[model samples]
Target: MFHHILVPTDGSPLSGMAIEKSVALAKSLGARITFLTAVEPFHIWTDNANQLAYTREEYERISKESAGGYLDSAVAAAEAAGVAVGRVQVETDEPYRAIIDAAVERGCDLVAMASHGRRGVAALVIGSETQKVLTHSAIPVLVYR
Candidate 1:
């Protein structure tokens, strides 16, 4: 019984599949969808002081563009399925945090995302964002692999 569904996409094949799944689920339940993409902020290296001179405004602009492109695809898919949808592009270094924040801000009833499905050493080395969201989010999460 989901009224609003939040789907995060990173332009990956897995994320594409997740978007499709989310759209289908929303259509079946007569729910609206929110497609979100988080762009990573530019990293500043103190060792290379010259690089630190980069403007934060420039970084924010680039991040917004990047996230917008990814979210556009998800929006297109939802539109094709005749599902009502909204898009959100957030600039954040922490993708999981951004995703959860968007969901809460949008008042989404559920979050449907794709898992990278990392395992063992890889999982430990590059912690799963999906896992982190599952652990920390107050809203319900449905992961698609």
Candidate 2:
């Protein structure tokens, strides 16, 4: 039985589904949840429109706001489900490491997340934080497709 679960989201529809499912699972298990969103720091050269549009300070500010919105949504879901919840937002280039570190620091027993289900070249090129978490984490992971 999981006493505490960590749910990671990136504000995508896929992650939203994972948040809903994780809240339901936490409710069923009488467990508390920690919602986490890892925000990547702004880089000088990048393809991301948001990063390209703003200065470092502006990008950081915008990223934090976005992450807060995502975490708030998850918290609301868990609250509605009667599942106790907390949230964490971290700034990191490596979101997978941030997710794992947050789970361990927060004492979460399970890490529940969504998978984009990429394969072959797409996965290899874009890389998968979910895949990295699955590979690196010592704790249990429950993936929602």
Q: Model 2 over residues 60-142: C-alpha lDDT tens digits?
A: 88778877888889999999989999998877777789889989999999999888532211111013888899999999999
TM-score of each: 0.80, 0.89
Query: What's the lDDT for residue 35 in model 1?
Result: 90
Per model, how many backbone clashes are there? 0, 0
Best-fitting candidate, scored by TM-score: 2
**Prediction RMSDs, each to the true structure:** 5.6, 4.3
Candidate number of the best lDDT: 2
Candidate 1 residue pairs in clash (backbone atoms < 3 Å): none
Q: Indicate the worst ten consecutive residues by lDDT in candidate 1.
A: 117-126
How does each model score on lDDT? Answer: 0.75, 0.80
lDDT by residue (1-145, candidate 1, tens digit) is: 8999999877776778889999999999999999987665555643322225446576556546655777888899899999999998766657789888989998999999988622211011013888899999999999987
